[model samples]
Target chain A: MSVVDLSKQVALGIDIGGTNTKFGLVNHRGQILAKGSIPTDQYNTPEEFIDALYKEIQPLIDEHGVEKMIEGIGVGAPNANYYRGTIEQAPNLPWKGVIQFADLMTEKFGQPCKMTNDANAAALGEMMYGAARGMKDFIMITLGTGVGSGIVSGGNLIYGHDGFAGELGHTIVKPGGRKHWSTGSEGSLEAYASATGIAITAKKMRAEFPDSMLNQFPEEAINSKTVHECALKEDPVAIEVFRYTGQKLGEALANFVMFSSPEAILLFGGVIKAGDFILKPAKLHMERNLLPIFRNKVRLVFSELDEADAAILGASALVWEK
Target chain B: MSVVDLSKQVALGIDIGGTNTKFGLVNHRGQILAKGSIPTDQYNTPEEFIDALYKEIQPLIDEHGVEKMIEGIGVGAPNANYYRGTIEQAPNLPWKGVIQFADLMTEKFGQPCKMTNDANAAALGEMMYGAARGMKDFIMITLGTGVGSGIVSGGNLIYGHDGFAGELGHTIVKPGGRKHWSTGSEGSLEAYASATGIAITAKKMRAEFPDSMLNQFPEEAINSKTVHECALKEDPVAIEVFRYTGQKLGEALANFVMFSSPEAILLFGGVIKAGDFILKPAKLHMERNLLPIFRNKVRLVFSELDEADAAILGASALVWEK
Candidate 1:
């Protein structure tokens, strides 16, 4: 077989967050050659944001010149719609109301651009380059500030009727259990399974166990990472916090298994750093709750991609998706 | 276009139940031309049941003779797998182990046969001939002795990797709230939203309200139908029973909506006969629980097919599906 030069062909991936907008040039094999970021808060409008992006991204394009083939652009952001290519009323965005993000990017860069919510982009990336490779039916869950999910069924992401499916985070797992800090929803998966939720659990648990290592840190300074550090040293309070959180997460995962019967459930982002402490209880509870036919059939594992670069890689994978 | 005779074309539909096995010959317009049933209780094995079916159905085919074309066979049964075309160990059925029902049907009748769980077939029937007509993304829920569901996404039934997906009835809605008498699983949707659950609710509530009409009936005789009659007579106790059951159902529906974002959710089977008494509360609670974007978007309605014929109709629809 003739060798093909992969370095010459690249896709531009952009990840837009509440504070920062990061862009990267990625090849087909999930390699990021060049990357940069700009504060998303500086722009007053989406149009201005697109112009600023063009100004920064154009230089990177010129640096490669005619030697590289810039295939297209793929973007991942909050509240983005794949069908309409717009971001509608995202709570944390600088722009208000509906912004035609994909249209603006395509026009500014003179290339086709596709957009989807960040969780979905991460799922696509996993399908192409990460833990979910060669698997057609699975769930990609991000355990960050909020729990986010992308459900793939029969090798395709389920977009549903209005292209807003797979909001697993908001599904009530506890039923009037814990109120979400922002959405004000009661007993959602995000209210218990997220890093923010873990921190909340740590604060509550450490206060009750005064002699625990978790209590050594100041109240305001305690977080998931600090709890993980405490658990590493065999702190019972920190360990119990993860056990309870994992129990909730596992129960929710069982519900999802019953709904879609996926081949696997992949966990990603910060919460997974606790390792076996979280995974053991999660796997045990999930198996216990499922029907006998479903038990021992689903594989539960953590993501293999680096969390920092996964967003860009996933967005770029969307460019190569049919 | 030239008009064609519909009477000349027909498909065979079979619904296998615990006590009785029903079959029908249906035309393209969803009309039943011939129907019959055999006692499934008498058969010792799946092969014996297939032989009994052949003996009963051969006479109907002979009656049509050269005038009609029998296209294929479709079957709906409990614990059936679409991918494997087999019925796994269903507790209600007389068969002891896995039954290769489709293969047996194909061998005996010399026709291509497809099979799925009863609920999935109902969803297909709805899509072809009932309330879910013209809908690509929707969910079909049957509130019978037990709750059952069939999820449709992107114009296809989600059989998932294992073909054991869409077991919505078993999903835990109330977590440690109620115990399923048969499965022993606590807090499942079927534990509170089914006809069996309604009967249990009526028994518990009427015991407290001594003057209620529901107390007039014997506890063993009190079913969903009795509760409906008493509720029709403006009995507050009966009404409260449905309100509680509907509240549990509505919360479960909200969880489903968040997971799939379907265009509509169609309710079928006995419990829906309560009409607005159940519908009003289910609608209210569902909308109240949904996020802002999902609120007021999903249409919740009852199935349009006749209860007696829906099973056969849905089974026949599978023959026409691609």
Candidate 2:
């Protein structure tokens, strides 16, 4: 039997985040013909989310006269499993237990659809169209509310035996310090590198650097974004926070590099918007902590892809590659 | 050109360790037809070692009347690189520079030959004959004086971008504590997991348990074997040492499982002789530290093959698989 010409067809890629669910129609070339996002709260149930998604996305495919050009749908949800085709208990997402979100999409729209965890999807996206495009072995780290990571080796995502291999965020940069959700231990790398963790660190440091410009913001109001903004203004405390956060991230990455020496480590997320604040310190600390042989060989690069578009492109590319 | 038949062909496998170098002729079924080990001396030059190896091995091949029956030769050495077909600056070996060890054999006997790091050879061995015989994505860790590891993914060894992907032993467990050379950090898992490292930990903990039965043995004379013997006697100090060693190893493996997620982690070496004393605690701690999703999934199994012959079979299997 002749296999269908999937390589020429397009796919719908969706990224469901806490605030918004982004959607796009993408072709095999990693090009997004159209894209948009709808507030996640607009849909209370899984059925409502699918309906709202179709309403927002149908027009894009129709506008481009590519409705017939579409072959499948691919989704990147918070806790999705590519193997199971379900999102299981994503803390940030309102869903509970296993949600056969893929079945719902196919039942309603009649298309072949695939899904993977958000971090893995992002990694696939980066490999398909972003900083790591054309690269086979690399890691994508999203320094967001909490640390989430995706690993690609030999052009394949390392989903382990159970499909949850890339948990780079909670690798215990600090053995037993701060309590983090991923690992029960305290002071994990995620506890320090993530947005919420950074905010907590900023609040604690606020007392030490009260005379510094970081004191201008209240403890409750501080976030990774504010810290980045203040660091850019040369606020000593803010700069120190980014430096410390990067140091922890870098050290943890060094350990990871030893396990699988990828060509590069691509960093993304709102926290990374601090640019050099996090990148410079992270590189320094990582070099200091890395094995001598791997010190200069590995590149710690940044992702250039836009977050919303990246997810869609990645999800679409998943189907394209298959 | 007609391809050579391999059904009856055998391969000669040699494992060069610090103390003894083992040699064997193994058939395609991973059965050893002949085998022996010769003491490796620090004072001997590379040329002398090869000469001695040939003297002992030639008779075995001749006695078995297998000169034409042998297909190739494969060597697994302390710091061998398959791509380079040479040993480059192995830590335990006195060799200072690059040595074309495989070429030396091929030149002497005019047989096809290949070489790889010992741990990688073991992985290929497992893939060909032992516990991971059919496994594609798994890691093999050898816990001797120091820890060494090899990775197999997608039915082939992951050479990584640089032929060094499976350095699991070196993946840091303690980021800022006393680092062993292997893991490139202070307080690395290797610092406590390797036989030498475990001995060190046992020696240090000996002070804390001075009143314990283990105190009857002199601290200077304590070693991993003595500690194991003591643990057999239910010595609390020895048990505690293994417990700490298992805990640290388990936590370190938790980090590794997050990266590779192989079907099983195959453990080998003298330290493993303690069996359940080491494995039971290690598994318990590993399960505890593992991501809730990966609690009891990744198996930490031991190699069932005889330790003395496993390396020879593993090395021979390398050529057999190719």
lDDT per residue for candidate 1 within B1-322, as digits (tens), equals 9676666778898988888888999888899888899998898888988999999998988886722488899999999999999999898899978988899999999999999999999999999999999998999999999898999998889988889999999999987778889888889999888999999889989989899999888878999999999999999999988888888889999989988889999999999998887888888888877888799999998999998889999999899899
Interface RMSD of 2: 2.0
Tell how far residue B195 is off in model 2, in angstroms.
1.0
> i-RMS values of the candidates, in order?
0.8, 2.0
Model 2 chain A poorest ten-residue lDDT run: A180-189
Q: Is the docking of candidate 1 incorrect, acceptable, medium or high quality?
A: high
Fnat for every candidate: 0.79, 0.60
lDDT of 2 by residue, A99-127 (tens): 99899999988888898888888899888
User: Model 1: what is its DockQ?
Assistant: 0.81
Task: List residue ranges in candidate 1 displaced over 4 A.
Answer: A1-8, A66-68, B1-7, B66-68
Over A1-322, each residue of candidate 1 has an lDDT whose tens digit, in order, gives: 9676766789999999899988899989998988899999999999998999999998988886722488899999988988899998898898989989998898889889999889999999999989999987899989998898899988888888987888899999888888899899899889989999999889888888889999789888888899989888999899999998899999999999999999999999999999988999999889877888798999998999998889999899889998
**Native-structure RMSD, model 1:** 2.2
Candidate 1's TM-score reads: 0.96
